[model samples]
Target: MNTPQSMMLGWGSLVVAAGVSFYYAKKTINERRAVQESMGQRPSEKLDCASFLLFLHCL
Candidate 1:
């Protein structure tokens, strides 16, 4: 064929960029899941404590 090395370099760069993007995307999703789990627990725990305190105060 004998076209150009620049075309090959451009394709290689695109592949590397895609790999990096996929890695960061996985990491971000994992972090979000962990945060959502922790945030989901906090409010119920606080409500439980508040309800217990109110029950004792009623006596």
Candidate 2:
């Protein structure tokens, strides 16, 4: 692909990956919160953005 097309494709892939990661992270946080609530414990804070970004980097 030409330079502009390559750049666009790269960015598009990154956006899709980030969206998928965020979806899974949110789902996991909700599940964990539910488990904590069921056990009479308080729900912890949501996962931090830095951690989420690191996760994306690893993928």
Candidate 3:
């Protein structure tokens, strides 16, 4: 009984962490794009996407 409960709790925390990371990554990517656009540079959507994947892999 205690084992299952502990396992579930661990899994729940892991899922929550992943969700938070994804959210932050998107927010960061958007902010960077906005800044670059404002500065008159052509924002690379592919770079943003690749960075996001790299972030996930590092985690």
- Top candidate on TM-score is 2
lDDT of 1 by residue, 1-59 (tens): 54579878888899999999999999998788778778884342335788899989999
Residue 18 alpha-carbon offset, candidate 3, angstroms: 0.8
RMSD of each: 12.8, 10.3, 8.7
Question: In what order do the candidates fall by lDDT, top score first?
Answer: 2, 3, 1
Q: Give the Å shift of residue 4 in candidate 2.
A: 0.9
TM per candidate = 0.55, 0.67, 0.62
Can you tell me which runs of candidate 2 are displaced by over 4 Å?
43-59
lDDT (C-alpha, whole model) for all candidates? 0.82, 0.90, 0.89
Please give, for residues 1-59, the per-residue lDDT of candidate 2 as tens digits: 46998999999999999999999999999899899888979745667899889989999
Cα shift from native, residue 21, model 2 (Å): 0.5
Q: Please, what are the lDDT tens digits per residue for candidate 3 over residues 1-59?
A: 56998999999999999999999999999898889988989655556788989989999
Q: For model 1, name the residue pairs that clash.
A: none
TM-score-wise, the better of 1 and 3 is 3
Off by over 4 Å in 1: 41-59
